[model samples]
Target chain A: MKKLMNVPNDVVDEMIEGYAAAYPQYVRICAENKRSVVSSKPVRPGKVGIVIGGGSGHEPAFMGLIGPGFADGAPVGNVFASPPPDPVLQVTKAVNGGAGVLYMYGNYAGDCMNFDMAAELAGMEGIRVETVLVTDDVASASKEEAHRRRGIAGGFLVFKAAGAAADKGYALDDVVRVAQKANASIRTMGVALSPCYVPQTGKPSFMLGDDEMEIGLGIHGEPGVKRGKLGTADEVADSLLSTITADMPLAAGDRVAVIVNGLGSTSQMELFIVFRRVARLLADLGVEIHRSFVGEFVTSLEMGGCSVSVMKLDDELAEMVDHPADTPLYVQK
Target chain B: MKKLMNVPNDVVDEMIEGYAAAYPQYVRICAENKRSVVSSKPVRPGKVGIVIGGGSGHEPAFMGLIGPGFADGAPVGNVFASPPPDPVLQVTKAVNGGAGVLYMYGNYAGDCMNFDMAAELAGMEGIRVETVLVTDDVASASKEEAHRRRGIAGGFLVFKAAGAAADKGYALDDVVRVAQKANASIRTMGVALSPCYVPQTGKPSFMLGDDEMEIGLGIHGEPGVKRGKLGTADEVADSLLSTITADMPLAAGDRVAVIVNGLGSTSQMELFIVFRRVARLLADLGVEIHRSFVGEFVTSLEMGGCSVSVMKLDDELAEMVDHPADTPLYVQK
Candidate 1:
């Protein structure tokens, strides 16, 4: 229970309060639905409203991405649990600007169930809500089962492209097409050297021996494909990237955007070390890099590891990916 | 030591290579000095050049801040060790821009000696250089000896003010004055519940019993003023904010910018919990918050703790603080 929190049950409430207070210009807690965070910027009419949500603990993921050029709203949930249909429906309705609403999030069972229910509810009200599930964690499944792969850091690329598309006044179907393409083109894989604690349990969700690492752990401490002694940053990067590129069969002439994400406890210095290897390996393969991002975009609360995500880009995807975005946690100009 | 690095001795070099590769648009390693990181943007003549540096563990601090609206260059060092004079002198010479350069860093003995020597060397070459040491950690010393206090997250404010001032084309002396004023107005304090391992040492730097926390700990695991059972986020925020306000004697109606900085391992959710209390406490005290930043701005490598910094603001300082600055880690527009 070494976490700096109040009563374990109150962590989400207190965190939501703090988040709204800290970034008043960018977001505000939804008055109609306490669990939803809404962007402060006015929604433009006839623009596809972008809504993203998932479990808590992965700060700056679903909530921090809410702004003018990003998600219009995010329904926050309890730690490692999906937001219920009530809040999801509330947020979808609140952000609906007559063009329709798009619900985007990681591909998880609970999230899939809840968001589906929300979409049905919105349909009853004639809101025309669409959904895109991100499945980019290459290590989560075999190539034949790519649709079953879990989403990780690669969700960031999906959000960026979809948000940019919606901001461009694209129709709901067009925005959904862009989001699905972004999700399909991205791949991510991660390694874990340490476990994260759950406040409710007051203990680590999993365990690893000293000097050991897991090759492909999930954000919620789900079992990975392998566990062994920790290797150097270069070795770890090679293993993850090889798993990813093999799954996608990326070509030498492909241009990609790269992201080296820290899973909470990993230092940015270590991420850069990993990124160095990623860049060199891609260069060796003749895969050109269009842009690169390195920092804590997706995280497993205090879990020690890093994830690398690569998104193959075409001209349309490249333009949307490079579009300017300004949010509390991310900014591009 | 669960760190992702190759041969601990080569960590710094690898990190530098990776950083340059990851952020080619923002920075590049100095050709003449391998340890220096220079901004990719061209320096405008007659503007005071800003050079910031320190140890290597605090990622996105010294290096991430090098860009058009921030530092011009940063001399890299080994983990938890001050950089030598060679890289400092080289960076100073390279970013001179025919005007002058301002050297700013935390108030530390090794840094003091090294930067002083660099200034002397630059002086001999007719490259005018001034130094401003940030002393904002209120718990490091008594108010009577405030100048002897250590710098922590508050140093970010000093860098922001100085960078904005220099970007405004202020003379070297004027930029120095603005930096000194910012240093004087800011205060910071932190608490640590776990220790960080140094890659070179292959073990933790310090130890804390389970369920215990040390208040006012230094960035390098230095001893704090008190040790006790870990408390709630609200209680911890109260303890830290009370100490900071008392030392500065901040009065009602005072406006300030607040930063709830994660040392390294603390989750952003916990940071928001602490910040919720910070905003509530300040409101209760009748103090107005102009802007707030909550994240890992400055960090100890994987240390589980957080620091709070407050900068009392006047009109000039407020405007400069809000001025747009674009860097790899920070951007305002």
Candidate 2:
């Protein structure tokens, strides 16, 4: 649970200041609200603005995803906590253009309520704002309760698609449509080998035995399928993907984008090993991996674990997924 | 000390397989030797080939640094252990286009000896090869013994400059010169908060108290400056930068590129907090930060800490640093 920080109270503020300074070419802090981080690149006058945000522990999610072809603005929260409505409103206003704006975030209760409130405020300002709740973590609920599932690393793809739509000058409604469609087709499941610490707190947020691991754990160390004896990379991949494929039902000839995302403390070495198993399993099922992303896209402090997210791709989704993105942490051409 | 892998002995082999599978568009294992990972993008005829490599465990260093506009090939070794001369020879043969090949790696004793042998073999085969040994880790030795200093994350910049030179059609000697200049201008220092366990050993590589940290730690568990009570991020960054600036003697009106590198388990949040202090310190000295890179550029398994690297930039080095590179773990335009 050790951390390298100054005063715990100053963690978020100082971190954001450092982030903006480190990535001056890509991001800037909002003048109205210090917590709101926006792309330095301006959005066109009539283009729909894409705004994505969530808790602060997920570094690249809310912050790293803001750039030329991704989310236009991001309102960062305290670690594992949702941002207040004011920052969200600030981000919405900053990124808003003549075509209105779209708000995308994980399907957490605090986030939904705060974002809805911000949307209402934006509406009063004559800006048409829409919301796309990313409910892509299949492990959070049964398939029958898919709408209730929480979002995890799979939201990376969901936001990527919406970002591409906004960058392509899609209308607000179209951007929301693409985000929702991407969310519906994506599923993620994660395993936690250890717990993480919140900066303000000096203790672990949760607990796990030395020889135990939680399959399908939430990003913030929420209960998973079950905490059991630790398994090998292959076994963990099989468990997570089996549940995901069962829920999404990928058949032969289906093309998909695979993300073997490290939660926090896990290394790329281990993530790629898990990805190797994921590739073999999918090939056995005769599914084609159109694209593969293996690294820490979304994280939870320094938690030790990883997640596997698969987004079933079609013509439109594939094109959006292939769109260019130039962000602080992620760049593609 | 828990890990996600099938077998201890198979860690390196399987990890390489996973890396090649995850980035099939960018890399492939050489047919002659599975340890040799070469770029999928073919090097043009008469272009000086960039062959970079070292031990495994540092996932993104050798492996991730191979792609378009980067290293043409990388011969991966077992965890924290150097590769034999054979794989290096295979990599030389695979990347040798017509102008010959350039070997770039850290200045470890094993790497120097092994790569030297490979260069001798390539010369016997009539392929002229030159080398640039990276010795940028200022913590390893004093300025008087700078040539004996080990390379750390600063090797990332050295290799990057050389890669751009090769991609820009620099001759073997020219690429070697660029890499050498980049190495001479760069300096790096690191701190370790805890120990990491190798897959095969299943034991901590070194030891540290719960409230202790080792300043000036190397990539492996090599001896560092000292072990003492852990300090705040600001204090640590100050200490590291003080030593580095004292060694390099940067003055006003100087421009430099900085890298705040996470060893392994350290999160980006902490790294940026560290980078924020680094920015402030450099600003106090009236130094211009040409660019800043804050993330896991190089690592040591799941070690918990970070390193700070700064490279003095002239127009030539700046262009080489800013050149486009497409790699699995890193990308830029």
Candidate 3:
């Protein structure tokens, strides 16, 4: 793969510089070692600050949502790679807000270890800190142990509810509770029709024949639970949603928000086709949809196929879901 | 070429039904013939209503931007097809608000004629209508005749600015001015790495080998101006940006917003790789970037490749672009 960089090592740095320059009005970086974009203006003095970090390829998730009512700071790592603890510490220190800092991100092993190290370092500096790892992609693990499902699309929902909780002056534990609740209620399953090529590798992570699809694929191109001849939209929707429903059954009259997220390479038309079946199936099961979004929300780089995420909502979750959010990633009213 | 639909012909309608059902709070139907979405609540009497429409497959574009400060209504047609005049007229009539409706969309010939006809019909009903067709695809037309270029990702910039202008209570002509300014200054160029298979056709829209890419391709699967071996992110960005800058010169001190959009199957990683090049190139050129968004904006089914868009900004354009706008498609502060 041809790239437009001085070298492969400079790619992430250059991208960050451009992103910082472009969104200066909304974000600013600390002079510290780890690259971090703090809110242009802090929310309040002596308030708990939220810092979210992860790999860089998922635009709008770790970067675009860095503003008020979201992350106070985001220390973005390179493509699919977690940032070092140094950057995490720098970002936490910059957005301390005098009260504390909350570290939130996906439940990746690399990320967990690095952020934990960063938290320990920050704590030594007398900065109070807490952490919540979002684990929402149910397909990553078995139904009996859904918590082990790697976090995928539900990162946004956790960020929204927790960010709002933080913005509403909730304490650190309360904010964590909101995020945990959102994560627990949210379930996602994905399929991969094609694989994405890592820039450094220049080779596809996986392969799928023209007539085949791997259901329950991981966002990072990990092997799925099943691979078979491609099925119809209804069948795919049923296959994916059945697992999600079995894990989190929405009783009749239950209200939920659905997200048919394209895993990078899938088209919106295909996502919506599956969404059509999802909506029909949910309605036939007597579930009421509050608000739904179908798009490439969380994605595996260039992978073909999509994931369906249903967030079982109560009045609180519904309000937060409907709350007006002004991020480059998503805006809802 | 695999699809999820049971039948190709019913795909569009089924998708619409799901869209309406999923987003009832944001959409409404008129007499069971027209589909529309409300951008703001408690419609402000005499406010200039902004209406945009196009084909259905371009989710969040023709329809997704319908929300506060952006588009009031978006009526979609079949996939990659223009909406009929009745729904256009109905959306215009429903959101007239006495100030008139500003019809904005891409510069496709079908859309141009049908929206023009709708404007004429709406005018006969005492509704003042002005239209601005986006011609921002610099690669498709010669520099001297860039206005004839087909609209692509650049439509997002124009839609955003017009949405903000309408929110500020700009009169019909003034809103038209913003849209025109955005269209004139914005430029986009796309390349397709693989051909897309239309659902109804079950065949490739265009043909290309595994090692090839078609540069400057249209979003509707139209052939690009050039076909050559697939190249690097830097090479692709340089080719697309050079054409855009040559057509819409970006001087040392000029501020602009950039959009690195996936044509469809391109991953965020690849898009970021492209954005990495684009940002560095613009920086080397000494251009100021006000904002940058990279993702799947306007897509062509599941075709792999990407497009780059740049919108030059003056003081007026910058303010409008920076202004608060909310839509299902995009949101900004």
Candidate 4:
């Protein structure tokens, strides 16, 4: 397809330059690297700083959530691919206060290995660094194997609570624990209508018939748990919600938050249609929903379809969820 | 396409039922009506409640912006169609706090006339009502007649600042003035790659070649001012941003905000690609961007392509832009 770019190779650099230009008040591109950070200068004098790194495509996922009460820096990689360790290290060092730094990222193998290496490298520089991984995609594993499920949209909740805790001056381990607590209480299930082509690869991550959808697909285009005929918004919601709820198993009188997220190509109308059904299904089961958001949260390039995320809430989780936050992708008062 | 709906006609209502069912804590639907109010129960007396309405297809557009400090009641209509007069009246009456109601909506003729009539009907019932129309789509009109342009993605700024002002307890007239001022300072330009089908019509709203784009198209599938071969992300941003900047005429050293929005089917990567370029171009022109957002804000169902919105910012606009507000669709703190 014709595009306005100077060339394919310059796409990433130029894109970063543009992002820095548009959001100069909220963020800036590190002059030393392509990583992004809040424009507000990071504070020093011994406070834990949080840094999150990942590929660029899952917006509001990694980059969109960077700001106060969130990440100090977000090093964006190429589309749907992990960033190099160099940028991660750069972000960690830049955001590390006198106390230490903590790194949070998805459970992707490349991300886990690379970020861990970055954290180790930062430690070598006398910067105390720690890491927490989010793994909340219930469809990727059985309940007994929840730890093995691929991380999906639930990472936002982890990021939000953890960022708030960190912002409130929690120590590195406490922030990590709160984030993990949020992660443990959440689960996600997703379906894909079409495959998203990686720019570097110039090919779809996967393929399905026009009349079908792949359920339980990873954001990286990995195969889903099931490939079935395309269903209505209600059925899609039922299928995804049932999988998420069944995997989580919330009983009556439980309060939860729902996120009906579009992968990429689905419209908000389509997402709302799904939300309409999911809301009804939850109500019929006597579940109380505290907060609800429907949009493209963790998208897979231009892949069609959506994922449902339900975070079973308790008083602590509810308080953390309702806490004030400021981020490019989402915010709450 | 097969959907999870009980029936196509029941889709919108079912979705409303689902929304009310799920977000009972944050919002509640009016009895037997399509309107919803943020559950800050026992709204302070004499508070000027903001009411916004539009067809529901825009996802977070009118409805998504409903929440504390933004809109009190969002009366959603059908897919890409205006809410009928009854819901408009009910929503206005339901959210009116003895203070008076400020009706905010896009500048579509049907919506304007319907909402105007509703205001009159509500006024007849001794409820004070005022209306402010948002007209920020610069691409649809020549500079000489810019006020005639339709409201596109730029309407978000109006919803945001107005909601913030109303939450601060502005009177109905002042709230309308703030929204109008924001709308006046903003201009948007959108291009469509593919037309989306309205389920009610069961057909494409418009058509285009794979290599073409329709610039300045209305949200309801209205024709744009120009249609041409599809361009690169940079080229699209150049055309859209240049038109927006020129229409608003930003001075050197002036600060502004940019919103690069996807028209549904476009990828977030594509929007970012465009955002990167637009930011660079604006920087080159000596404009300082204070804030920026990239996502699917106002969409045309599943249409491909994106829109660029620029709001020339001053202290008031900037403060309002930075004010704390929350809604299902957009948020700021």
Candidate 5:
């Protein structure tokens, strides 16, 4: 209830308005669909349009990534809630060039249903649209049930690959192929030390004992694999990496991109500490880190935790990962 | 305290080790000075070197800014503590090209004393060193005693201007002048809703009632001017902007760069809400926003609060702000 909001009910609208005002050069709210945020820079005609969407609490994730060499548009939703089909369709229509549009988002039931409906609506208008569900959270499912895993920070890598491939003028189908491939290669797991509050409800999405931590919690406070006493950064990193690598099985010579992402309230200082342990563990396992990112990328609302994600990279994915991107929240060159 | 640290006493060293590991591409620990982090990329000959240092908790500040077109070296200290003179001297020696070196840090007593000592030591070794203390926290002192005000997030602007000026091969005196000018043109203020715990202390820096907020709180949990019931984001933004503009009045034709920085725990969604109001207030006053930065730049561990910084821009400062620079945390082109 200590959030800096105007009214609990208006959090999403005010946030979107503020975001548009702050980054006028990078994005603008769609005139026809107030919930849709589209890049100010028009999408090139031949490039595949990348449309990303999800709930609104996770800043710079779905919307902040809309810019050149990134998502073409994002249909923002209420906090921890899915966007309606209207905004998704509108965003697709706004960003659809000569090529088709791709819908990428986390694997959530509400999100999947809404986006699917939007895709159907887009298809009725003769626009080609594809959907790629990110399911990289290793702790959410066993290897044989990978499709059941929920997406988390690893979606960033998938977005990067998809956006880069689209920027390279890949066909819509090829972009989807690369995105699916990137999705398959990435794995993520998180440890939650505290819970996050939802503005509308004025309550934490979940609760945890002060001395306990939950391993593999979802972005929206979904149940993780286990709850145990809080451990040191090194111990937590080991648990996350063990869970992730067990599912993905990284080899000594394999190259990968790593993300030590804060769940929300965790400090960058702590993330780096976790990253230190993760880097050493990976080195011992013979996995070469092609690039490393440590920060708050995807987050719950003021949750205290961190997640580790690894994207096993091939030459194509490596090139895509290195592709230049400029967005409000993240930038690379 | 529920912190992700191995040992409270080892937090500083572990944080430094993790930072070095995560960003080996940009920096490395100075062999002789374990406390100093010097850029892996050497300073160009005859360029005025920029050396920034402070406590270790503010990740991506003193150290993350060390790279091409930014700080050449950063001597890190323990949590919320100023670094010793030896490491500062070592960093100065390591990055001191033929020209000279600039020592930039917050206007704090311990830092000022230690850096002054470092400059004297560097002088003994025949290295030229100049200092610019950032004093931009309008809430910390009256306008008549602005020089006594504590430095805060506005220091980022001063650093960026100084680094850009030096990178452009400005003479030492010119670089110092520009840095001072940048510092003079910037002002900042913050509000804290909750306290951040120091790892070693295992207690919150300060205390607050559940529904209360402290306006103009310092980054290290220093007391602020007022404590009142938490208000809407717009109301908070109005109070912060009014205080800042009163000290450093802006004209209708003025242009400025604005940063709505989260102290640590504020969600990006809430930050945008604050920024929305900030933009409207500035626009109503006829001040043009040259650029907007909305994220955590300088932070206070996991403090729950935010600071707003405004740098009034003249043509020279505007150009310097627009200059291309890339660091781990910030990149502009």
Candidate 6:
């Protein structure tokens, strides 16, 4: 596969260096651990610290979500791999302003293990730490076992809810409460039209025939719920929304914040087309779209596909959704 | 080519409909012309109206750049083709406050002819309009003939300068001056690792060998100045900045803004890797980078490549760069 990179092993380090260099006004690498990135904004007293992180390939996710009214820090990992406990500990210590620290990330096995270790280490230092696993992907498990689901791209909104609450000087318990609530009220599904390449191995992550697509494909290119001939944009969108609505039980008069996310390589034109069908389908269902975000939020190294995520917005969640944020990747006034 | 679109012929319309639907608070489709988009914010009484447009494939360019402190109107065209005079006229009328309107877009034959036609029509209607064609692609023309160069990703900075001026309530002629000045001070060059596909015909814009790349490729996947085997990220970035610095003669104590823009399918991992090298090269040259933007800005469907743009920031230009813009794709406070 053709890729624009130098030594593959250094891709992660170089990416962090470049990201920090490009936005020094927003973030800085932790002095203790190079892999950990702390917000340029200093830790505020009495405010709960928000820390997020995951594998490095998904640009502008955990790391990109660091700035004013966002995460206090992000401990980065290697491509498609979780960070070790040391960097996570460093990030937690750097962001702790005496109140406490809150840990948020996608619901992945490796992430859960590493973050749990860091939280244990922080507790030993007299700093309280809380954790919230974003499990929003509907395709990963049955609604009865929603806690076992994967996070995927829908975690953006979940993090938004937590970050907004934390930035508002909410207590540790309150921040954790809103994050868990956001996770519970969300569902996401994605379809992959093409495979991605792993930078280190220089190999395809998965394979798909020219006329095929995998519905509900995970961000890491894992197998999806269904594999079938590639359908039209509307068909694929309708399929994703139908599954999500069924699981979430959305109905008339229910309001939501919708995210039509490009996995990677999929253009904004395609994402908007997908959103067009989604809007039509939701209108037919009598549901109201209070806010719409259509773009590449989470990505898997040049994978071709899109994901649709819906966050049912109750009054509390709606306020969090409209809260202003200033980050390198996302901004609102 | 695998694409996530339905009824290829309706892709453009659907995309626009979805985009407007997604940001109704920011934009509205013109009642007179469906292809024209006007800012939902009514035309400011004394502010110079900023109108930008081109083809459909380049998302977030002319269309996505519509909102507060950005373009007030955008007239979209078919894939890689310029819009007709009707939409342009509609956008001109929609945005023309009592002061006047300023038209800014890339330097292309079709765009020039169509925009000039609209300007003439608007002139007859008693609305004074001025035009500034961005010609920042250094590889397309020499310094002596820079006006003939094709505008590529660097047009973002050019438009930003003009939009900021227009929103600052400058006269139409003053907005045109800064836009022209920005076009002259900026230099951009791109490389293509893969080809893009048009939905209408469903064919590749160009072809490259398995391990080859085209340097200085245009946004439309047009022929580049050089084609050779793919090089390392550092090597390619050095080549691009080397050429830009050569044209602009950057030196010690010089300050500027940098943009490392992904063409389409290029991932942020590769972009950051590229930016690391760019920052290194500029640092070695003793140049002070005032700001840096690294991500996908202007795209050609799903072409895999990137572009580097440098804008020498004088005090006047620096202020414009730091100004606020709240568009759907680009946002700053």
Recovered native contacts, candidate 4: 0.60
Models sorted by lDDT, best on top: 6, 2, 5, 1, 3, 4
lDDT of 4 by residue, B181-295 (tens): 8988888888887777677667777778768888887787665778888777778888888888777788789888788887777776667778887887887989888888787
Segments in model 2 whose C-alpha atoms lie over 4 Å from true places? none
- How accurate locally is residue A241 in candidate 6, as Cα lDDT from 0 to 100? 94
Chain A: TM-score in each model: 0.98, 0.98, 0.93, 0.94, 0.98, 0.98
Tens-place lDDT digits, model 3, residues A1-333? 322334566666666765565566677767886367677775587667888888876666687677667778888787788988998998888888777788888899999999999999999999988888888877677767765668887787778877777777778877777778888889888777877666677677777788888987877766687888888888889999998898888889999988887776676767777888898899899999887887766676666788888899988788667666555455554
lDDT of 5 by residue, B1-333 (tens): 798989888887777788888878888899988899988887799999999988877777888888767789999988888999999999999998979999999999999999999999999999999999999999888899989989889898899999999999999999999999999999999999988888888888888898999998888766578888898899999999998998889889899999999988899999999999999999999999999889988888899989999999999999888887888777776
Which residue pairs in model 1 clash with each other? Answer: none
In order, the B-chain TM-scores come to 0.98, 0.98, 0.96, 0.94, 0.98, 0.98
| Decreasing DockQ order of the candidates | 6, 2, 1, 5, 4, 3
Q: What shift in Å separates residue B149 of candidate 6 from its native position after superposition?
A: 0.1
Check candidate 3 and list the clashing pairs: A2-B232, A233-B4, A302-B267, B39-B67, B60-B64
User: lDDT per prediction?
Assistant: 0.89, 0.90, 0.78, 0.77, 0.90, 0.90
TM-score of each: 0.99, 0.99, 0.91, 0.92, 0.99, 0.99
Model 3 spans with C-alpha error above 4 angstroms: A1-10, A34-37, B32-43, B209-211, B280-286
Each prediction's DockQ against the real complex: 0.81, 0.82, 0.49, 0.51, 0.80, 0.84
First chain of model 3: TM-score? 0.93
**Top-scoring candidate (DockQ):** 6
Task: Please give the distance, in angstroms, between residue A189's alpha carbon in candidate 2 and its true position after superposition.
Answer: 0.6
Better of 2 and 3 by lDDT: 2
Candidate 3 docks at the CAPRI level of medium
DockQ of 1: 0.81
The superposed Cα distance between candidate 1 and the true structure at residue A162, in angstroms, equals 0.5
RMSD of 2: 0.9
Collision pairs in model 6: none
